[model samples]
Structure formats: C-alpha cells, structure tokens
Target chain A: MSFIEKLKNAWVSNNSLLCIGLDPDTEKFPDLFKTMAKPEAVFAFNKAIIDATHDLVCAYKPQIAYFSAEAAETSLEQTIAYIKTQYPHIPVILDAKRGDIGSTAQKYAAEAFERYQADAVTVNPYLGLDSITPFTAYRERGTILLCRTSNSGAADLQDLSVDGIPLYQKVAITARDHWNSHNNCLLVVGATWPEQMAAIRQLVGDMPFLVPGVGAQGGDVNAMVKAGKTADGNGLIISSSRAVLYASNGDDFAQAARAVALSLRQQINVARA
Target chain B: MSFIEKLKNAWVSNNSLLCIGLDPDTEKFPDLFKTMAKPEAVFAFNKAIIDATHDLVCAYKPQIAYFSAEAAETSLEQTIAYIKTQYPHIPVILDAKRGDIGSTAQKYAAEAFERYQADAVTVNPYLGLDSITPFTAYRERGTILLCRTSNSGAADLQDLSVDGIPLYQKVAITARDHWNSHNNCLLVVGATWPEQMAAIRQLVGDMPFLVPGVGAQGGDVNAMVKAGKTADGNGLIISSSRAVLYASNGDDFAQAARAVALSLRQQINVARA
Candidate 1:
C-alpha cells in the first residue's frame, strides 16, 4: 500500500493524530533493560512501548541518529520489523533529516527503506531538488520535507525572505505544484510555530503535516490544531518524543509512556472538539 | 594536534591543496575488485586510492554514504584506521552533513569522532547553536559548516536575504563571530561559485575552507584557487571525488585516479603561482 494510504488508514482506524518519536538515549534506559546488550535493550524498550500504545497512535517516528550513535543498528531494524508484525497498518516515519547529491541520496533512501524499513523519511531542503528527487521517486514511500522546524534557529534560514517570500513558503509551494506529482510528498512544520504551520498548510492545501515540538517542547496542542488543521480537522501527525517516551524512567516506563500518549491524544481530540 | 595545525602540516608537507573525496560506488568498481567480497572490495579499493595519491594530496575526505550504501560499514572503519596508521598526519574529514537537536547532536558527534575516528566531520547548521555546540566543543576536531553549497538549487535558501544580508553571508558571519570559539571551525565554500567563495573569503579572513565541486561538477578549479585562497595561498582543501576516484572503470582505475589527482594538484599550484 502507498504511504499516504497507510497513514490515512492509521489515522482513521485508530482515530489518532499522535506520532510517538522513539528517540532513545542509553543513558536514560531503565535499569532492567540497560543490563541487556545495547541493541537488545533498545529493541526491548521499543517493543514494550509499541505493545502498550500501538493501538492509540497513528504512527511511530524514530530518530535514526539515536541508533547510529549507539551502534544499535540491528536493534533499530528489529524494532521496525516488530512494529510491522505487531501493528501492520501503522506507518513508521524515520526522522532522519538526510540531504546529499543524487547518487548519495539514493544510498540514504535505500538505507531508510531497505535497511530499517521506515515507511516515510524526513529530508532537509538545504541542497534543493537534485538532493531530494531520488527520495521523492520512491512512489510508495513518503518524502516529508523539513519546512519550518521546531527549533528557534529554524528562523535562521527557513524564515529568510526569498523575493519577498520566506524560504519555507517557497518550499511548500514547490511541494504542492512540482514535487507532489506522485502525491508522495508531505511537510514537517513545527508545532512550536503554529502560525507558520497554518500559513504553510494554506499554501500546501491539505497535504498531511508531521508536526513535532509539543509537550516537552512547551508547544500548545490547542494552538497547533486551531492553526494547522485542514477543514476536516485531521491533517496533522502531532509528535511528542521525550515527554511520551521518557514519561517515567522506572520499570513501569512503558505504562507511563502509554499514559502520556493517551493524554496527548485526548488533548489533541479535545482541541479538535 | 588541532585540526587546523594538522591540515596546515599536510598542506605544507604535500605542497598541494587537493583533498581527494573517497566516494566509491561498487557498481562502478573495476571487474577485478568486484570479484572480491563486499567489505574486502571496498577496503581494497580505498587502500589502493589512498596509497596511490597520498603524497599528492593535503587530506582525504571519505563521504560516509558510499560505505553505508553498500553496507560496507566495517570497511569504512578499517579504511579510516588504515589512513591514520599509514599517513599519520593527514586529516580525514568525514563528509556527513549531520544535523539534529542537542542530545542527538552529541550522539552524532560520538558517531563521527569516537566511532569512526575522523579528524573532522561536516555538519549542517540548519538546527543552529544547540545542534552545533557539541561539535564545536571538540576543540581539536574541525567542525566544517555548510555555508554556500555548490549545487544550482543552493540559491533556494542559502541565497535568500535575511534583512539586508544573504543567509549564507550571515552564516559566514556567524561562523566568524560566534561559532568558531574553539578556532577549529571551517566553512564549506564550493568551487562552483567562486564569486560567492571570494566574498566569503573576505568575510572570514584566513579561516580554511573545505571546497568541493571542482571536477565532475563542471566547476572551474582555477577560478576557485584565485577566488577562495587567503593571503597565504594555503587556506583551502579543494576536493574532487568522482573525477579522481572513477577516472577509469578498467583495471588501471587506481593509477588513472592518481594521474588525475596529480594533474589537478599541479593545475592548482600553477594557479597559485
């Protein structure tokens, strides 16, 4: 199935817009799991989290650097495969902001899809079209472009005016008119900057956004929904990484994580209501 | 023992400014090497290139994508170790344009320095200070920041105006005034835009620039030397990847690569004269 179809399926069937970011730090892993092998521990923690809240989330977003940093690559692969087996319909977005020239980009696309089996991947727009075309060519896979990110420095270049328009607006327009021919394109607008997210949504027109920066980042879910939602009120994948994943560092971390996920999802629904 | 000191030592000792980019594509490898095992083949290919051109070059830049694309991860580690042991003084700038939030950036820094043992690693400054501070904290390692890239679509964002200044110019200024506190930071100024390269050189004074886009990208090498050089005429690492590495697809590809690197070096020196 196409990534968009799977995403929509997860959204409607699960009745959710929350994407749990699995950004693991070994330093923060619970004592019981930390005693296992590095890869084993990561997979265990991820499996426990997936088991608890797979039903409540539209998707799971894992940041690849966490695995690469720890050399838990095999565990990341296992984590993705486990999710596919346990919850077959829920998509996984690899939050790897990869950007390179054409050939190298092809390699990274392969790494994200073939090695880790991520349904969607995030890419940086720094190098422009040629850097992105390889990933966008994967008709079945989703290409989520980083537009206005959650961080303050996102304004460093992303908000700079290009011919009287900010660079992110141009990116949204480009994705809408040029790159979305396969309809495999999406945008990542930070929940921290809901106004920019709303403006970008207007420009891109109903293209699904994978919004990060809420909860731990102090972004209000209410503002995000009011500003970023399409007319249907369900066009955003609101992501909360640390607040959900590390809700409690004890043995009941999985249960605590589920509690956080459920609350965030409920909060998003409340805002929609 | 700092990146600049080692880079300067290589520059003077080698009497060359060329940094050969080791971006080996397996499909493009010679039939002879193709018969070897994947990891063995990659290591052999890299060793051959390094051995042949070590004397003619200032540094070796290995783009991590090539190894990751082929799953030749072990070979990449071995390749870096081999360079450090065989050519002890030449720096290896691992061209991984990594960017993420702070804690994640620390992991990437670990991946580049502790895992691979690269003398320097290229980082994308999109996420700003928090993403970069961990990298800059490694005072002995070179933190090469992407300023004005060589690709045509670089104008998409890097060329956009922030107030009255272009974003890239602002980046150059940021690197100059704020980020280079450790005196280990460098900027990536492409040979494709010698005019912008020149303007950046004036802004940055004598800070070393790790330049690409010299050969396969149709960038003028002579113009780059004339425009990008500091007053000392030794403040650049002009890199050429495919043009040198894949000069011949036959069995003599290694020798052919050496010939190209030598000619490129001589041409750069002539321009310097």
Candidate 2:
C-alpha cells in the first residue's frame, strides 16, 4: 500500500493520530540509564517507549539527532529494525528536514527511506523543487515538506511576503504543483499556527500534513484540529513528543505515555466527528 | 586551531586550493570494479581515489548520497572512517545540506559534526537563523551555508528579489550577521555564477567559500577565482567531483584522477595570484 494509505489504516486500527516523537534527550533520562552505556541506553529507552505506546500511536517520529548526537549509528539502525519488526503497521517518519541540490538530495533520500526504512520523512524545501524531487522519487513513500513552521523565528523567512502572498503560501502552492508529480507529498504546518494552517488547508486542498508542536511546545490541539484538518479529516498527523513520552519520570513512564497518547487520540477522534 | 585556520593551512600546505569531491558514481567506475561486489567495489574505488589525490587536494567532500543510495548505514560509517583514518589532515566536509528549526537542528549538528566527525558541514538557511544557529553553535567547526547554487533551476526562488536584494544575497547577509556570532560560518557559491560570487563576497566580506560546479557542471575556475578570491587570496575552496575522480575508466584511474586534481589546483593558484 502507499505510505499515506498505510498511515490512514494505522490511524484507524490504532485508534490514534498521535505521533510519539522519540527525541531521547540524554539529560531527561534517569541517572541509572545514563551510566549503563552509550548507544545501548538510548536503544533500550526507545524500545521501551515504542513497546508501551505501539498500540496507542499511528506513527513514531524518531528525531534522528538524539541518536546521532551520540554518534551511535548502531543504535539508530537497531531502533529502526526494532520498530519495523515490532510494530509493522506503525509508520515511522524520520524527522530529518534535509534539503540539498538534486544529486546530493538523492543520497539523503536513500539514507532516510532506504537505510532507515521510514514510511515517511520530513524535508526542507528552501532550495526549491529540485532539492525535494529526489525524496519524492520514492513514489511509495511520503515526503513531508516544511511549510508554516511553529517556531518563534519562523517569521524570518516563511512569513515574508512575495508578490502580495506570504512565502509560506507560495511554498504550499509550489509544493502542491511541483511535488505532487511524484504522487507522495505532504506539508508540515506547525500546530502553533492555526490561522496559517487554516489558510494553507484552503490553498492546498487535501494533501496530508505532519502537524508538529503540540505537546511540550504549547500548541493547542483543539485549535489545530479545527483549523488544520482536511475536508475528509484524514490529512492531519498530530504529533506530540515530550508531553506524552516523558509524561512522568517514574517507573510507570511507559504507562503514563500511553495514557497521554490515548487521551490525544480520543480528543482527535471527537474533533474529527 | 579553528576550522577556518585549519582549512587555510591545508590550502597552503597542499599548494592547492582544490577540494576534490569524492562522489563515487557507480556508473562511472571501471568495468572491472563493477563485477567485483556491491558496496565493497564502491569502497575500494573510493579508497583508491582518496589515496591518490589526498596530497593534491586540501579537502575531500564525500557527497553522502552516493554511499547512502545503497541504503546502508554501515557504508556511510565506513566511508567516513576511511576518510578520517586515511586522510587525517585533509578536512572532510560531509555535504549533507541539512537544516531545520532550532530544537531539531541541534540534533543534526550533533549528527554531522559529532557522529561523522566531519570537520565542516553544508546547511540550508531557508528556515532562517533557527535553522543555521545550531551548526554555528559548534564554535570550532565550520558551517557552510547555501547561497546561489550552480544548478539550472536555482533561479526559481534564489533569484527572486526580497525588497531589492536577491534571495541569495539576503541569505548571505543574514548568515554573515547571525553566523558571525559563532565565527565559523562560510558560504556555498557556485563557480558557475562568478558575478553572484563577487556580489556575495562584497556582502559577506572575507569569509571562505566552498565553490562547486567547476568540473562537469560547466563552471569556469579562472572566472570563479577572479570573482571569489579574498584580499589575502584564501577565501575559495574550488571543488570538482566527476572530472577529477572519473577521469579514467581503467586500472590507472587513480593516477588519472590525481592529474586532474593537480591541474585544477594549479589553475586556482595561478588565477588567485
């Protein structure tokens, strides 16, 4: 099945649209795991989180940097393998906002989709269409391009006006026009920007969106659902990281995470209906 | 010493400002290596090329995609390790062209700099200061921001004017202002556009540049040097991939590659003088 179809099926089967982000902040982990080992501790923590929340989430978005920071290629490989083996239905969106020239982007596409085995991957579209074309070449996989981001500094470029239209709007339209040629394109609109989300949805029609910035980043889930959801209510992949995964520091961390995921999922379902 | 100092020293020591790109295109390899094995043949070819051209060039940029297209993290790790062990003095720039929001970008910074042990990395500045900040945080490492590129379609967005200044110039100015705080930022200006290179240099001052498009991309090295050279004649690192590494298809490919590197280096030196 296509990545989008698989993702929708996963959302329906799991009864959740919550994408648990595996940031794996070293300082947040308990002191016990800190001293255990380098990449082992990271993998163990990730595996436990995945096992606990597998049934509650439609997808798992592993922020590549956390594993990369440790220079732990082994842990990264093992994490992907574990996800593919344990939760075959769950989509994995490798949150790597990579964008480069054509020839170079081909390698990044291979690294994220082929090596990591991610069902979907995040990309930066600043270099224009050619930079993003390589990722969409994997027609079966999903390519999530950054549009209106949730950060405070997003206005620096994304909010700039280009010929009376905001740059984000242009990016959304251009991505829809150019990237759709490959038939696997999605936009990343931060949950924090509900108004922009509504506007972008109006412009791009039914393209799937990877809506980040919900949990610890203080984005309102209700507003995001209301503004960002497609006409069919299947286009939004609401992602939360710290609020769900690191909900509690105690031994019941996994259970606490599941509880948060369930609540978010239920909330999304109600909003959709 | 800082990365910039190290780069300057390498340029002087090698007597060649040329930065040979080790992009091992599988199709360009000799017929003998094609029958040998999968990644092993690629690795063998890369090792041979690096051994021959190590002294002829100041830096080696391995376009991560060539090895990454194999979809194997082991190959990526092995390739980086080989460069570090075999050519220790020649700085290795992993041309990943990664950029994202501040929080996410911190992880990429750790990945490219800490994981791959790359001396320098290429980044996209479309996300503004947040995207580029994380890389500059590594005060010791060099961060090359994308300016005007050598590609045909780069003009789509990069040529668009933002309040009288072209997008690439604005990127350069912003990178110069924000990246100066860390003091380890450079620009990626294609050798194909010498006029843009001259204009960008005026905006960013004496910062070093990684100039691509010199080989098969039809960029004139002499024009690039004349336009891109700093007052001290140490600002440009002219890079050529296909022309140098694939100069021959026979067993003597390494020697043939070395001769090309030497020629490019000589041209750069004479042009600068």
lDDT of 2 by residue, B183-225 (tens): 8999999989899999999988899999989988889888989
What are the TM values for chain B, all candidates?
0.98, 0.96
Q: Residue A114: error of model 2 in Å?
A: 2.2
Tell me the DockQ of each model, to 2 decimals: 0.61, 0.54
TM-score of each: 0.97, 0.92
Judge candidate 1 at residue B220 and give its lDDT: 90
Model 2: residue B187 alpha-carbon error in angstroms: 0.8
Query: fnat, candidate 1?
Result: 0.51
Error of 2 at B175 (Å): 1.1
TM-score of chain B of 2: 0.96
Candidate 2, superposed: residue stretches over 4 Å from native: A30-36, B31-44, B71-89
